[model samples]
Target: MHRVRPLPNYLVQRYHGWKATGYADNKAWYRRLASDGQHPRAMVIACCDSRVNVISIFGADQGEFFIHRNIANLVPPFQPDGDHHGTSAAVEYAVQVLKVSNLMVLGHSGCGGIQGCIDMCKGHAPELEDKGSFVGRWMDILRPRFESVRDIADDKEQAREMEKQAVVTSLQNLMTFPWIEEKVNAGELTLHGLWNDIGEGSLENYSPESGAFHPV
Candidate 1:
């Protein structure tokens, strides 16, 4: 806990700007949000890419969407062991407590984590293959998807396709949680997969019936 420290000068200045402009202008709304506990209708699980702005792209306002950012937006299979589980805890709390009706897994092009997974699986990134590597271990969730795209002949295409697969895989993994599955089975919850092309600035939604992603 003691490892925490104050922000650097650049980030501090940026925070000051946001606090002065955005936060100050919306003080009343922020205060109301603080008074009334958040009741977001949807939960968006997206990548940690700085360019992929889920809230901005959807034009969602504060307190409207519950967002969780993780590497490649991948969800690991439900593990009940007594250990740290940030992603799983967030999903559980959102579904079981917040009662978010919709859960969207958002993936994006040029995902470094997805690329690392591909490289690691193909023996190109030996550094990530180490047993103690957190990123490597977490990315193992998408390792299976690599094999499906391994023969695509183009590295760029393979990475893009695998990025989409991360969303698909996470949706699959989300159901592994008993609470999530129960809510979904009761028709109280819905699952969605989304992908964004950073360069093109286009969004796509996964079609369950067609098993493909279509532009939104």
Candidate 2:
């Protein structure tokens, strides 16, 4: 790891502003917002990639969306595990407590995690011999997604297709939550699959009709 770092002047100024957010005149506004309680209308499931900041991209202010992020932006099917599940827990709170009306699975191009999943599925990378290796097992969560789209295309097209399929698969898996499913069926909630092309600053929405992502 790099032992030293340079602080961007822009970030330094932002830090100063954030630090002052709780002082004097700002404190009342903060307290008022907190007292009103968070009632975000949407929940976003996004990747842990630094390039994809959902809040900034959507131009959101505080308490706009309850977000859950993980490697490759995955959403594992609901299951009880002894350990803490940060993403799942956030989802539970977003649905049960926040009562968000919409859920979005957001994916982006040039994702390292998706690339790794592609590699592993093509036999170009090593699989975990056991479930103990954290990262190895983590990517394995997308194994079914990988296999589902394996024969759809070749070369770069294949990779892109895989990434999109992964997003759709995660959105489908999101229904594994009974509360989410119930809400969706009753018209209380909606799920969307979104893909962002970082280089082009363009977005696409998944279309079941065309079985493709359309520019949005």
Count the clashes in each prediction.
0, 0
- Please provide, for model 1 over 16-40, each residue's C-alpha lDDT reduced to its tens digit, 9 standing for 90 to 100: 9999999999999999999998999
Regions of model 1 farther than 4 Å from truth: 1-5
Score residue 51 of candidate 1 by CA lDDT: 89
Looking at model 2, report the run of 10 residues with the lowest lDDT sum.
Answer: 127-136
**Candidate lDDT (C-alpha), each:** 0.92, 0.83
TM-score of each: 0.94, 0.84
Return the TM-score for candidate 1, rounded to 2 decimals.
0.94
- Model 2: pairs clashing at backbone N, Cα or C within 3 Å: none
Leading candidate by lDDT:
1
